[model samples]
Target: MEIVRPHSHRNLFSSNDAASAPTIPLYRSAPPLEVRLEDFESFAIDRLRVLKGISDGLSRGKKPDEMEKLVSELWKVNMRHQHASEVLNKDIISHFVLRLVYCRTEDLRKWFLSMECALFRYRFRFLTAEAQRAIMDEFDITCKAVNIMEFESIKEKLGQVARSMGQPLPTGDAIFYKVPFEDVPELVAGRRVLLSQGYAYVAMNQVVSLVATLFRSQLSKTLILTNRKWTSSIREQEKHRLTPIVEALCSSYLGPDFSQPKEYAEISLKDIDQLAKTSFPLCMRHQFDKLKEDHHLKHGGRMQLGLFLKGVGLNLDDALAFWRAEFSKKVGLEKFEKEYAYTIRHNYGKEGKRTDYTPYSCYKIISSTPGAGDHHGCPYRHFSEENLRAALSRMGVNSRAMEDVMNKVRNRHYQLACTLTFEALHGVPCDAGINHPNQYFNDSQKILQPKKDSST
Candidate 1:
């Protein structure tokens, strides 16, 4: 394997003449090149935007024509914004930078790998046949095209299987990939294609699904291995290089921006009840309701609601007081202090790990499973259809809006349901995807508050 080490102090792509230019590798490494912090952040954000757009497009279930247009639009935007000649280099570098930002924890790591694989699948699927062959060679993926003669011989069997799986078998004009039969469990389980002596004959249209699975698995393993090698020495050397760039990228769009306290400070514990009724996402709203009505919450509910309250500018003292007041109603003052005070302080970074825990993102909340008696997870995902509809109805979501949101939920687009919920409550289109709970809160505030008037 060729390691793509960038020259210490030069442009990755300088010459316009292809014959004279160096061959860029499939992946690029970060060089010890000095750059303005702004430029570094801009590059990473541009790539992040592309990744996010891909994720959003997938969630919407775009058709082939729409998907092609979307990818082309994203590509043009990225290329126009950056040096067009070094598009590949910029893409590779930004990916590595984001890996640093998102690799700090397990949830971030899963999300990064998932989105990156989807982006790769889109790009790979759109490549010309010759281009696909080159990439396959570069990546050492053993998958190969099944020629017309081979496909013709097996077309009948393939068609039979495809029909059984409720998928169409491609004609001779379409390409087929001969991959190991064991690799594509989705296709295999669906009986979507024929398996020969050892290979699964997958249609060109379905190839992306297989590639994405393999890509995500390989990339996930690589991240885990690389994380192990990221020792103190490596972090010390790359802290300046990696930390600021990732932080700026994340803070700008992907995650919470803790530096901006004024926005969150607009609301306090005093207004939480009213605000929960109006602004909180259904998951948090349910937790708040249960906390108030029952005067107790399971561990999961406490963690979910506690961090959200913290994100909404509830200070350590205020959080302690709020929980103490609520819990003391049932547990009494002494038991509340002994049993709950320390945990609340720990959430606020006053005890235990001392790590300032960020509130759960929409991805984290929806992906988590709530057990019996727990009301902490995304309602759209965890609730039964009847239960979810009832919950939404109680929250004043109109029937039409409830139907639309539930359709997305039935399709397992939980995040999109949350996005629709944002739209329903705020009465405006939220163009950006809803990925984090704090983001939902912030967006609600932005829409609810007048631009000229900060006095909420």
Candidate 2:
């Protein structure tokens, strides 16, 4: 591989934001690799194996004791891996922070370690290369000529810098609060609380493992690998806060790309009723069929129902207009009055519920579906063409040109689901952290520095 000189923030692993110019300049003289391009089922089959063994052990042995052993074993592996994988796979880390990773080679570890002294000032395109160099020099100088600041002190100093710059704070998986435990409801089950606590611990370990894997994906190899059980205690915090953002952004991007016509395709509900005979996503077709044959609903009935309400009175072109008007009114219509309102119009303007969807209009539908395990409503998985046709038939959905939509569903092209509905939920601001104690980044580093065996 050709060695490209590592430039600060520009070329190195810029965390999850490679989509943009790099901000941190790597200090290395060269890089090792180039990253350019970026499974769900039968997973249960493997878990079933473990479950059977554990069950047998419990039945043939001391039940609680066996359960304890089983739990401990599962805990160990989960703490080491899964939680972090969830975050990394979900792409939350890149959302909040600028990431940087130098192209790696196994042989360079010792050399990189020796030269990492001037690490802090490494600049990227965002900052001058000189700025990065300066930070690195200062870091090096501090390591050598001054006191070595622990990661905690460094984090605080960085936090101060971030505040001074008016940038977002660097976050970890876990969070801490001043709230005392005594304030919790006495009626709450002690075991449930304990379970939640256990899950919290497991979450932090996952975050660390996630960090490790993220390093692998971006930098091509794992860094600061987990031992057995770590990252879990903090991960649940991030998972709760980040999941919504991921859903919104990914869904937005993955959502149906709407076609803006010079004029809207205006059709009465009665017209749509005829078109409902055929459409994509079998579910909608079937539902429309059911409504027509069984309930004998008319275009008026279907149109009044709305797709979400099982109505097909209006075509997608008009439906898009309907949603745009709904949220535009809800958030208030002083477009010229306030700047943020405009931001809302520009972002969540067209997409349903995800107008606040930043970066990408991607969303994950969490609906009631089998095997969805809490997060469901992916049209690719849930939709059937016949049912969709039936539902649309009842709703008077008039669109013979819905073949494009069916193609998306038959191919499991899920993001296309949002496109057909031309209906996006409002980009709801997720303030879940207010009630969720776990969303706060953790302070564990103050007590325990991240290290090789830090997970244990």
Q: What is the TM-score of each candidate against the true structure?
A: 0.59, 0.25
Across 370-415, the per-residue lDDT of candidate 1 in tens digits comes to: 8899999999889899988887887788888988899999888888
Show model 2 residue runs off by greater than 4 Å: 1-266, 278-281, 296-305, 308-456
Best model per lDDT: 1
Per model, state how many residue pairs clash.
Answer: 0, 109
The lDDT values for all models are 0.73, 0.30
Q: Which stretches of candidate 1 lie over 4 Å from their true place?
A: 1-49, 61-86, 92-253, 257-262, 451-456
Error of 2 at 219 (Å): 4.1
Candidate 2 lDDT over 365-384, as tens digits, reads 32224342221134345646
